[model samples]
Target chain A: MIEAVDLERTYKLGDSDVGALRGVSLSVAAGDYVAITGPSGSGKSTLMHVLGALDRPTAGLVRIDGRDVNTLSDGDLAELRNATIGFVFQSFALLARTSAVDNVAMPLLYRGMRKSARRKLAVEALEKVGLAHRLDHRPNQLSGGEQQRVAIARALVGDPKVVFADEPTGNLDTRNGEEVMKLLGALNADAGVAIVLVTHEPDIAAHASRQIQIRDGRIAFDSAAGRDPAAA
Target chain B: MTVLEGFRVALEALRANRLRSLLTMLGVIIGVAAVVLLVGIGGGAKQEVTSQVEGLGSNLVIVVPGKFELGSAPTVSRLQLDDVDAIARVVGDPNAVTASVTSGEVARNGTREMFTSMVGVTETMTTVFDRPVARGQAISATDVDTRRRVAVLGSEAAEELFGDVDPIGRQLTLAGVRLRVIGVYAERGSAFGVSRDGEIHVPVTTAHRILGTERVDALVVKAPSSDRVEELRPKLEQALVDRYPGEEFSAVTQSQILGTIGKILGLLTLVLAAIAAISLLVGGVGVSNIMLVSVRERTREIGLRKALGARQRDVLLQFLIEAVMLTAVGGIIGITIGVGGSLLIDTFSPVPAVITWWSPAMAFAVSAGVGVFFGVAPARRAARLDPVVALRTD
Candidate 1:
């Protein structure tokens, strides 16, 4: 399980302090499917970054599998992100010149696995995303939906405890977005993997079992927790 | 990451920007080639000089008056004919010794005059040095004992001064002193740029009268056996050194002369190599500049690698390895060109050039070290970047 209590993130922009996340708290258990919803600058994306261990919080605490985020060094944080969770970005952050299989095998590369061994796991992950035939094709050669599928394969290749998706289908067409959503549904339902995604679409938020809404750097609403006292 | 994997990624990155990488490597190539070629030319020059010294004669010890310190002119010639007799007694053959005092003078025959080395020598000159007479007879002991005004002309000197007419029995004037030509020396070719066949010889006793100097410039003693030359050198040196305790006499065989010449050439080669290494340092600076640009250009890639769990050392090592790979490949190409150039020069040019085994090897090592030394700053900059900010760069 992953947990956070009153996490706060602030940035200094020349003369002013910009608070991206202020007193936001959340939790997700094993096999849970959750969606965080908000408008632009609502701190929903900032919440995901902090929870995914990509950015350090300015205040409060975060724990993944009972280990405090504050206790880890930068290198330790990177290892935790690599071993315990996977991230899927809206931009499909795959190496441009690399083949789909090589892109998928990148996470395992950090673990010092043999090239052949990691490639074998990559092939299986690509098969799950219906990208087995496109293994040797580069990111530029693949279609938008195919590239997203390759990104999905990369996320699953490491066999992480949970998958964090920040606007995963924001760049896809209607049919492709539905297909990617369906893939997430099956991954959660059949494989018992946890999924936490950020989106503004009400329809996308409706897919998850639990929903949380962030507004002005604070948690405005949670379907499970009802209305927050601090919300505007 | 594994070393092999680092090399793989480095190779990939360099291939992505082939033209820029090749341009950066050009400096190293030129530098290494210069070093190797200069060293080769120096080595070959040394070899040629050694061979010429050995070819002159064998088992002959050249004894000169002075302290005999290297790189200094021989100090104050005080040796005389009596010292020659002393060496002759030690060698157990009175006929094995010869003395010479030489100076440049005009050899005038009738209205014609030419500059030639005027050599004053004892009668044993031809016999001790194994030089043969082409015509007439060599100077005998009677010639030196009686102080006769007779001379011998080197083949080229005789041809140039006497022309088609036979030089023997002709009168030639040296230093305004008339002398009868007794014999013509056989042909001995040039050594370095100077001709050995342009010298004119007379008996030491007569040279003292004409040149007006009693001091002998050189005392050459022929050892009985070639094997004894090494042992006899010190004995002859000791005999003369004992006679004049404060003065040092040098008695050296042909091989020792070769060694001295070799050492001078070796020093010249080192100086040339040092000058070439400065260019190599400039090449290293070029590599550093290009690598800095590469680190900036690939900031996003660095962040992505770190996000994928690459540690700071891994990122540092990747860039470092890339820089080293560039210089190392340049070094290999330079070596090939350098060795091939030495061979070409040796074949097509009169200037001797030989590729020694160590020149290319040293050049290669220096180029690789250049990579390690210059690659550090840029690689460390890449490693120190904040992954969060780096990932956000456009």
Candidate 2:
């Protein structure tokens, strides 16, 4: 689970200050399938970066799996990310020239797992994504859809509390995009894992049970906010 | 990640770019080889010199005119036959003393002629220097007393002048003096790069007349034993000093000469090795330069690893290990080539190369240390990269 309270992130772009996330507040609970949609430069990626413990916020606080992101050192933040968070980038970001199994088993390397055990767990995770037969294939050897599925297996191999996927289907064709979306849906439905997906496409955001639209570094709407009885 | 994983990752990275890795290692290879080879040549030369001096007999002491301190003008010797007698009395062996003057001259037999070293010497050499006449008879006491026109040819000189023909009892001319070859000296191997077999020996009495000089170049004394040389050297020099005050007569033994030559050769070898180490230093710089380029090329990988929970220390260790491994492996290749080269030189050339154990050992350690010394900046740069920025690099 990830929670952000008025998280603000600012970056310096040469001569001027660029505010990526301006007072954004959001939270995702256990087993939640949430999508944050925005145009390019809407700060959706920045929000995810802060909430996933990858980037420190310029202001406010973020809690990932109950540990305050502000209170952790850079190394401690890395360990927290290893234990509680997983990430999937649009490019897949699998190491070049590495086998699918080695790529999937990468996160567990941070967990200090032995090679044989990591490989076994990676195979199981790949099997969940229907890629068991392609364990030894490199990313360059795989099609876009298979590479995304391998990326999903890498995200799932750690058994993290949540996975942050930013534009997961941005580089795939329409058919491979549908396949990746279907795989993410199947994993969510069968395994009760929380996912915070960032996307710009409407159809991609439509797959989530709850959707939040971000415009100008702030949340424009939340699908579940009105449904919750606790929200006045 | 484990150290094993660090090595695996580094090795994989290097293996991925084979040519780049090899080029990066070239500097270190040349550096280490130079260190090994230059030092080996120096050590071998030292060994050769030591053995040659010992070959001349460790009991040998020579009293040369003037001070023998390095790099200063030597005092001239006015030594004569009386000095030989005085040296013979001090050593208490008349046959062990020989006073000789060496001159470079053209020796002729028919139309065949070669430049040769002609030594005008006392007849006592046959008993003292241990070189025997291989054919015919040696210089006798009568030969010196009568100033005989007979000469003993060295084996190489014999071969050069007469070829397959018998050299003994044949006519030979030295400088312009007509003489007969009475015998041929046995083969004696070279010493200090000059051929011993090119010398032609005539009685010292005839030498004074032909060379037109009464002064002996130096008085050579062969003591009864090595211990006697040590005992006799100072006494001989003191006798000379007592006989002729204000004239410095330096009496030196084989070991003293060996010590001086060994020191000079040792320093020369060290200087050469140091000069060679400069290329190694440049090679270290090359390693650092390539490592910097590699770190830049892998910025995204560094970010990804950092994102995957690699600590700064882990990243640092990975790159450092890669660097140390690069230089260490290169160092090994260099040592192999250097040793191989030394052996080749020793076998195929006149330059002797004696590989000491420390040259390779020191070379290896220094090369590895060069890795550590030069690797720090690039590795730190890698370790300090931000994960968010790194992962975003294309």
Candidate 3:
């Protein structure tokens, strides 16, 4: 489970404070397929970062699997991310000049796994993403959709409790984007992996079993509530 | 990460910029080679001097008239013939001492004439210098007492003056004085670029009479055994100083001379090695420079690794390993080049060179130390980078 109660994040811009997230609260159960949608500058990405333990909130409580995020040191946070959470970036962020299998096996390396054993696990993860044939292809050698698949394999290789996807298909074509969404939906439905996807596209949000809309750093709508507070 | 994995990453990074890595390593290579080669030359010079002195005799000691100081002119010369007789009496051994006076003079035989060094020695020269007549009889004590005009030709001098004819009993003019050659010396190789085979020897009394010099220039004494030489050294020195009163002279054993020369050469090798080590420092700077550029270029990769759970020390160690690997490989190449160069010099040149095991080993250690010393700043810079800021960079 992932939870954020009244989480707030701020940035100091010269002389004024800019709030990326203000009084935002959300919760996701295990095996939940949740999509977080928002306009530009609406705190959707900030909430993803806070929930994934990638960044700390300026104020408010953020917890993952019932453990307080604020109580963890930097090293402990990295361990939490490596062992319990995985991230899929917008730009793929796979190491250039490195093979797909190596990128997928990277997270396992930090766990002190031997190279051969990690590579075997990485191969299985790649196979699950339909990239078994492209294990040796580098980021530049693969198509945009294939790169995203490699990134997804990297995220799943750690067997994380929650996967945070930040605009995972932002650079792909419409067909590839639909394919990636279908793959993420299956990971949640069949493998029972929790996914917190952040995007601005309505069609992408519709693929999830639950939807939450954010605006001006506040939660504007929740599908579970069956009503939009902004409209009410 | 394991050490092997760190090295693998470093090796790949270096291989990415092969030309730059090689150029950066050049400084360390030259530094190590210079250190090894200079040390070899210095060591070889000392060895040559030691063997040359050993060839003369182990127990030989020399008493020269004057205070000896390197690169400075001696102002005192008070050794006389009476002092030699007094020292001989103090030793109380007739076969253990000889007195010699030397000069450069022109010798003529028919039309072949050459300027050669001539030494006027007593009959004990054979025991003192370990050079005995090879072809004929050495001068006897009677010859020294009689002050006879007889000469001994060095092997080279004989070859120059009398072509195929025997030098024994041949008459040669030495500085306008004609003397019959009684013996020809055996061939001895060159020392310090001068041939030892082009010398002539005569009786000390004959040299004192003909050269118009009453003072003895050199007095050589042979110890009865090697251990006796050390015990006699201080006694001879004290006796000479007491006899001369205010005059200065030196009575030095063979080992003392070799020790002085070895000390000087050892100091010179250390100095040259230090100067050469500066190049290795410069090479370390080169490593730091290239590593900093690599860190900047790979910022995104670093951020990704950090996101995947790499610690600060991991990044620091990766770059540090790369730096050390570069210099260590360069050091190995340098040692190879240095040893090969020394061997070539020893084989093809007049100046001998010897490569000691410690010299190359020391050079390698210095180069590795240079790597760690210069690599710290850049590695720390890489480690201190914020993953958020680094990931945002284009």
Give the number of colliding residue pairs in candidate 2. Answer: 0
Between the candidate structures 2 and 3, which one is better when assessed by TM-score?
2
CA lDDT of every candidate:
0.87, 0.88, 0.85
Provide candidate 1's TM-score on chain A.
0.96
Candidate 3 TM-score over all chains jointly: 0.89
Worst 10 residues of 2 chain B by lDDT: B68-77
Q: What would the per-residue lDDT of candidate 1 be over residues B1-394, giving only the tens digit for each residue? A: 8988889878988987989999999999999988988999998999898787767566889998765546878577999988888998899898899999998999999888899999888889998888888998888889999999999999999999999999899999999899999999999887666787999999889989887889899899888888888899899999998899888889987767777778888998889988988888888899999999999988888877776677788888999999999889999998888889999999999878988888899999999999999999999999988777777665
Model 3's CAPRI class is medium
What candidate 3 gets wrong by more than 4 Å, as runs, is A12-18, A37-44, A200-206, A209-232, B47-56, B66-73, B104-115, B137-150, B160-164, B171-180, B190-195, B204-215, B346-357
**Docking level of model 1:** acceptable
Candidate closer to the true structure by DockQ (higher is better), 1 or 2: 2
Ranking by lDDT: 2, 1, 3
**Per-residue lDDT for A21 in model 2?**
89
Fnat values, candidates in order? 0.44, 0.47, 0.40
- Give the alpha carbon lDDT tens digit for every residue of A1-232 in model 1: 7899999999999999999998988888888899999999998988987887777889999998677898889888878878878777788888886899998998888888999999999999999999889999999999888888888888888988788888889999989988888888888898888999899998888889889888999888887776665653
DockQ, computed on Cα atoms, for candidate 3: 0.51
Q: Which prediction has more favorable DockQ, 2 or 3? A: 2
lDDT of 3 by residue, A161-215 (tens): 8888889888999999987888888889888899999999888888888999999
